[model samples]
Target chain A: MIETRGLTKTYRGGRPAVDGLDLAVPRGSVFGFLGPNGSGKTTTIRMLMGLIEPTAGTARVLGQPMPGAVRQVLPRVGALIEGPALYGFLSGRDNLRRFDAADPAADPRTRSERVGRALDRVGLAAAAGKKARAYSLGMKQRLGLAAALLQPRELLVLDEPTNGLDPQGMREIRALVRELAADGTTVFLSSHLLDEIEQVCTHAAVMARGRLVTQGPVAGLTAAVLGPGGHGRLAVTTPDPADAVRVLKEHGLTGLRADGDRVTGELPEAPPDGPAPPDPAELNAALVRAGVRVRAFGTQRPSLEDAFVRLTGEGFDVAG
Target chain B: MLRADLLRSEIATTFRRWRTLVLLAVLAGVPVLVGVAVRIQTGRHAGGGGGPAFLAGIAGNGLFLVFTALAVTLPVFLPMAVGVVAGDALAGEAHTGTLRYLLVAPAGRTRLLCAKLVTVVAFCLAGTLVVALSALATGALLFPLGKVTLLSGTSISFGEGLLRALAIAGVVALSLLGVAALGLFVSTLTDSGVAAMATTVGLVLTAQILDGIPQLQAIQPYLFPHYWLSFADLLRDPVYLDGILRNLGLQALYAAVFGSAAWARFTTRDITA
Candidate 1:
């Protein structure tokens, strides 16, 4: 478990990077930190990992006071912050061994075997022997993950773990994060990609301009209430576009757009408690009343991307 | 334990670098060149008539000169390299992003710094040993083995000269430790290896400059490079211990103070990488 109470961090000669934030990540859950660039995501993770001190407030990891109890807390936590740093001349195995020196009493053979398994887990067993400099960006990121997994820890903190990854690499990383969470390790990750977070994270927190807007399970976030039709993609096909607009406006549903024979618009994440839709059962009744014939009507569920954009006000592309 | 691991890791990494090999090869060959040059020069000077004692006397006087030159020059050239190698031990990793992995493991900052310091001191010792071994071989071949004359005009045996050379080498190694500590301290403040190396070298050169100024003579003993040649006093009749011991004490003081300061900085440092 990780908890921060009113935590704040202000960079010297600069504005507060993380401002008066309160956060709690339950154990054994994949918690995603969502924010755009310069949104204080990295700063929060750094403070949680004891890389930097908080300007005010207190943070605890696994029930220990941050940084002050770092020596004890760190052994139980594993993290990869910022970009991966590696020794170009040393192979992946050698890199692990160097840090493994923290526990010198461990059996070298067992350590090597654990390293091999981690390499396999990250799907880079074939490239483990090659110098890190020879590996691609994706391979290096996986190697960084492997290093984090060399020894088991209760909490794993990863910042933008999937950045710069291709489709296959992204999948592998997503799978690894899932597997880690499945093994009962608390995974706290930060990413701007809502799709990635939606795929793996069970809970989430959004940050905007250094202050946390809100946080909770991804499913529970109440999308802004939309009137009658709902706030999601609705496909309406009509022979007459002019008639559909008139009908929709009369029903009090605004923000409508038309392309060719179809008039389309979104509802809200949550349907407003106003009036019900003209009732698909009454589609014929409504069409006849408005002097138009409705060919078809279908509703598309709002994606996690739309939910994120609505919550954070940051325009995002679904395909990305 | 981290110190031992760091030492082993540093040894493996530093010894394998092309630069280190080139340095070792060059350093090892110095005595051989000196021997050949002495043999040729003295053979011509003697008109092929002098006995081995004359040659031995000539070599003894020249051997200290060789030792002195190696001591003074290697401290400047080689320890700066040691400083560069050791200074980057942590800062280099931080700059490149490897430090995050290490830190997340939550290894004690004290242990890691200790490890880096020991590795650098090892390099310093190895560098001085190279000079000692090279000079010993050159002294054996270029002149007679027995050394009966001292700089104070007294006399001792060839075995005594060899022993003194070894002692002198130890002193040189201790002096270099001080240089290594200075580098490591600077290492804690930076993330750029090039910047750390440049800063360490600049500091060393500055100390050397201060040591050389006549007006700074009173403060010279405090400078790291000042007593680098004090090992020569060991070759005197009574074996002058004043300057050599004082140099060792000062080096010890530097190593302790700088090493502790590095630990303090490292523990409080915010490792962004």
Candidate 2:
């Protein structure tokens, strides 16, 4: 639903904020734009929304060239850029009404009904009569979400949609996103929270320092970091730590370490210097044969956070 | 294509603000203050002269109060009120970050600009009518009402004088289009509403001061405020159209120039705020 070709934005006398980004957001997919702060996610989103023109490239939203086609394309796209910007003096309901009125395509006769429904969807219906200035940060975030949902959109571009929400609010927003995706709306979400992307996104693009590091399905990203068979490290909790370590080493597990009664080591898949990795069942049997009193045996799978950190060469705020 | 709903929304939002109400209240209060002051001065000294153009005639015919109040406020108070409203039109939205929402609502840039200009022009008419109505009511209460003597010394019926008064109010309102357009142009240049308002009002004051200088007479006629007081000629026997037409024409020139300038700057400029 959204595509960009060599999209770059360079401020005067400064490095490009968003550099040569070629992004594709498929229709009806929950695409997560994963990046750290100042990684050009918002800049790219702004360019896509046509709020700011890209200095040197082109962005097509909904298959129409942006800025030039803004009048034609924007009515079908809903956006919440940066945060919820509202008129503090106006009540939340009035705010929605005003925005609804701004859209020439919005049906005037059904405006009030739609605004009320949107407010209810964001859980702001009770507070609709109150001035937006009196709303809390989380409420404001929800109101911004309400604005994006005011009109049924073909594509929803949200920048940091869950930024100021509590844990419950965040969960609610995530659920709302899932629901919207289920209805076939293309969602382009950007955030620094790795957990959010992992929990909600079907596809994601990782960006670092204005450059795209990688992009694909979330499962594939984690699997890529895990290598073949998707195995990471094997941990064995046993009474005989030395015996367990000796057996694990004999089984060709690399980087064996023992602490107290636990032993852990890398379960390399198809190691260049060794035979293929043994099945976990056979490894458990080998430990049992060594007379190690095994309490628990498991292979740890790599997480999306680990994959993202490795791919971006930087740490992300893993929790929202 | 101007959307009626959007225009209604703009008008509603602009007028609903306490700031706008206060500006109108101040405008309404001006006529009362002038009426009461003239009533007191006429009672104290029997003859009123050397105050303002129409102040001396208020005691004889209450209708003159409308003319007097408009004359008193037109040069400063009226345009200043319009300056506040027009200058804040776009910049205020930018300051509050509502401009982005409005634009992305697909309120076409040109259409939104048109809506803002229409709202500001509406304010101009509303402000002028407020002063005129307040003066008329206060005039009726404080003094007698009857025939009005024109500036050419010909007496006209009270109804004709009232029609002339409405026309004069209209002329006064049209006289402000230049300031309204100039303020809108200034609004597009900044994201700070206060800065835009101050700059617009400051420009008006500077132009008025320049129009007053004898040394600047060569360019005085080109200033937007040069023909502002030409509405007084409506009181002439034949109702002189020369200065009134010139005033309207000059305002149209400023409106066209600044209106296009605003459109150019607003449509092309980035909306980062």
Candidate 3:
């Protein structure tokens, strides 16, 4: 489990890279840290890993306050931040050997065996003898993952693990993450890809401009965005668009945009002034009273993209 | 676990690098070149009046070539090689982005820095030993071996002279601890290995230059390399220890000051790379 209390990091004379934000990751969940680029996902991961001390606030990773208890805790956590940080001159096997030796608790006697097992786990056994500089980007990324798997870690923190990989490579990494989760390891995965996070994460948190916009289980996020008070858009597919628009306008629906036979507007049920606005049934009855032939009239189910857009007021860049 | 187990890995990785092998080869070549050059010159002029001050007495005893080779390479070659290795210790990792992995290994920055220091000192000792051994071999092959006359006009047995040569090599290596520590401290300040290496070597040259200037005599003793050649005192009868002791004490001072400085910087550093 990972817990953070107002964990913040501010560069000298610059804005906070990671603002005062709290994050909680339950054990054995594939926790997705979602954000757009420059949303401080990497900074938070780095602070949790104790690679950079928080400028303000604090964090506890796996039941221990980071940096202070790093030695006692880091061995149980595997991480690959940014990308594969490797020695270009050394062979992949030797690089793993060097990393394995870094853990004081590691058995030096079985170091080579552990290295071999890790390399095999990441499917880099065939390229283990090649210098890391000669490896393809995907190979290097796998090698980084291999270094993380050198021991039995209770948690795995991967920062954009599939950043430069081909589609196949990304799928492979995603599968590996799911496999690790199946083994009961807590995986705190940070990514800008909504679909990747949605596909792999059971629970998710969205960060925007160094702040936590929202956090919850994947289904809960959808429900939160779709509930009566949530920002749900209404779309009406009807042949009698003029009558439907007149009926919707009478109900005081604002920001109506229509093209051809389709009329779209925000759900207008929640009102400030008086009695609750008519329910879908009442609205349909009212439209029927107006002699409007209704084909389909319902609130649009919000996608993660829609919820993210509603939360951050900017569209998510799914292109990357 | 208290001791840095990473030292083994560091040594293995460092010595296996092509850069380290080239450094050792160049160091070993210095003695052979000095030995062969001295042999040819001394062969022609049996009663030579000129050459290096150390080679002046080599014809009387070939073992003196060890001392002569140490002197010839100590100024630039040996220290330059030490500078490259020491400077590359941390900066190279940062350049290649491996420092992040090492620190996150929870190796603890102080412990990792200590491991690097141990590796560099290990190299210094190995480098000094290689130069001494190569010069001794080359000298033994080129000249006659016999009882060696001391600088203080006292003669010692050949075995005792060889012992002295070993002692001298150790002293020379110890003298370089200051350079190694300084280079490591500089390494912590930068991420570029080449820049750190060039700066470390530049520091050595700067100190030597400062030591040589008459105007800078007031600050010469404060410089790390100022008392480097003081190992020559070990060849004197009565075993003069004043200059040798001063040189070691100075090296210890530099190592302590710069070693802790490097530790302080590296431990608190935000490893953004």
Better of 1 and 2 by lDDT: 2
Residue-level error in angstroms, candidate 3, position B183: 1.2
Worst 10 residues of 1 chain A by lDDT: A221-230
Per-residue C-alpha lDDT of model 3 across residues B1-273, encoded as one tens digit per residue: 634568888899899999899999999998888778777887787766666557877767789899999998888999999999999999999988899898788677888998999999999999999999998998898888889888888999999999999999999999999999999999999999999999999999999888999998889888999888989988898888998999999999999999999999999988887
RMSD of 2: 2.7
Show where candidate 3 strays beyond 4 Å.
A222-301, A315-320, B1-4
Identify the candidate with maximal DockQ: 2
Interface RMSD of 1: 2.8
Off by over 4 Å in 1: A103-109, A222-231, A246-255, A266-297, A314-320, B1-7, B18-23, B29-69, B72-75, B138-148, B153-157
Question: For each candidate, how many residue pairs have backbone atoms clashing (under 3 Å)?
Answer: 7, 0, 0
| lDDT order of candidates, top first | 2, 3, 1
Residue lDDT tens for model 2, A1-320: 88888999987898888889988888889999988888888888878877888898889888999989988898888889889899888999999999989999899888889999999999999999999999998999899888888889999999999999999999999999999999999999998888898999999998888878788788887787655645577989988998888888888888889998888898867869877668989999988887888999998877788888777776864222
Better candidate number, 1 or 3, judged by lDDT: 3
Assess candidate 2 and give its lDDT: 0.91
The fraction of reference interface contacts (C-alpha pairs within 8 A across chains A and B) present in each candidate is: 0.56, 0.76, 0.72
Question: What tier of docking accuracy does candidate 3 attain?
Answer: medium
Give lDDT tens digits, candidate 1, residues A25-89.
Answer: 98888999988788888889889888898999999999999878877888777777876777788
